[model samples]
Target: MNIGVIIIIVISLISIAGFSRPELIYKYQFNAWQIKNRKEYIRWISHGFFHADWVHLAINMFVLWSFSKAVIYYFMRSLPGNSSIVFLVFFFSAIVASSTFSYFKEKNNYNYNAIGASGAVSAVVFASILYDPFRIIYLYFIPIPGIVLGIGYLVYSRIMSKRNVDNIGHDAHFWGAVYGFVFPILLNPSLLGHFFNELLAIF
Candidate 1:
């Protein structure tokens, strides 16, 4: 199985197991205060494995699978022999990078908690968008260009993060998407110009 599919399977199994064992869920779930107070730093990476429920897990795994193919293709073309390793780095880094803002923001909030693969999935999706900017994407059953959806996603996440009413981690989505979009370019700077050329080609 490809790394993306492997990840989905691994996460699904772990999440299902965690769901049945509340103690496992509590042990791995992201609690910013726990990291700040007890030095339980593993939560930064571990939280990505557990999720709120099946629907959350399904959505995240589906999105990660959907975009990972393209992102992996681009990585292979861009990074040659080290594609798989580099892609894995990107995926794992995004998980950590996506949570930094929240960790700092809620580090003192004893009640704050988060879970799910949304951040890492967002990273995969936005990274795919960077490679195929003009591809069509459905947003709420409405088709929009990939680049347009990327911008809209970031905007919505930013606005929602400030509102902070929903249980969803808009901050993670925002930061993960940003990390996904940028990490590849940092790995292979040539992609930056390629992205612009692809965008300009659309006009």
Candidate 2:
């Protein structure tokens, strides 16, 4: 099994367990106040293992599974040694990095809490887009190029983050997607040139 799928399975099981045990949610879910007052820093990464509901878990897993191979392929092909380990680091760190902005922004709002893998999934999706800019991605069952979907995703997430009208963690999604695009390039700077080359070819 691919590392990405393995991660999905692990998180799915944990999330399912969390659904039945409210305490699990309380213990693992991202709570800005808990971290600020109690020093429960684990919430930063632990939150990725829980979700608001099964639907939320399913959607995030599906997207992650869909794009996992592309990201893993590019990483293994371009980087030296232990690609799986490297990818795992990229994935988990993204979960935390994506939420760092929110942690500081909401730490004092005792009611602020979030649960889901959307942030990590968004990171995986954008990373895949970086590798295959012209690949086909289904947007609401309609075929659209990956690059187009990526742009739409970024814009929508940014706007939604600013509005904060919904419970959704658009902030995490936006930052995660940004991290996804940059982390790989950090691993291999050549990817920056490759990204531009593929982007221009899309014209």
Candidate 3:
């Protein structure tokens, strides 16, 4: 079983559990106040395993499923035997990295809470984008290059994060995407040149 499928199954099961038990979501969902004051630090990683609703869960899992294979393929090519370990670390670390900004921003706001795998999912997506910049990604039924969509996503997330106009964790999405794109380059700096070469090929 591939790591991505395992992740989907695990997250789906936990999310289903949260569906049946609202209190589970309340306890595990990202709450900066709990982490900061109560020291419930596990929420940093735990929140990514559950979600707000079926739709939310479906969307995240779907995106993860779609992008994970490509990311894993690239990882395997780059790191060989240690690729799975590296991929697992990348995924989980992205969850924590994505939430770090929110933890600091909302530490004092007890009412602020978020639940979903979107942060980690965003990481997977942007990682795939790094590998295949010119690949087509259908956004709301419109076809666009992966690189274009990635840039647009970052811009939108940044704007919305600043606006703070909705319940969506735009900050998480922004940071997760950034971490996803950077983590691979950090692992193997040569990948940065490969990314640029891929872009140059299309232009």
**lDDT value, residue 79 of candidate 1:** 68
Clashes within 3 Å, all models in order? 0, 0, 0
lDDT of 2 by residue, 1-203 (tens): 88988998999999999989999998888988899899999998999999888789889989888888778888899866677888899899999989998999998998899989888889988888888888899988999998898999999999998998999999999999999999988878998899889989857
Q: List per-candidate RMSD values in Å.
A: 1.0, 1.0, 1.0
lDDT of all the models against the reference?
A: 0.90, 0.90, 0.92
Distance from true location, Cα of 179 in model 1, Å: 0.1
Model 1 CA RMSD to the hidden true structure, in angstroms? 1.0
- Candidate number with greatest lDDT: 3
User: Roughly what TM-score does model 3 have, to 2 decimal places?
Assistant: 0.97
2 or 3, greater by lDDT: 3
Cα deviation of 58, candidate 2, in Å: 0.7
> Each prediction's TM-score against the native?
0.97, 0.97, 0.97
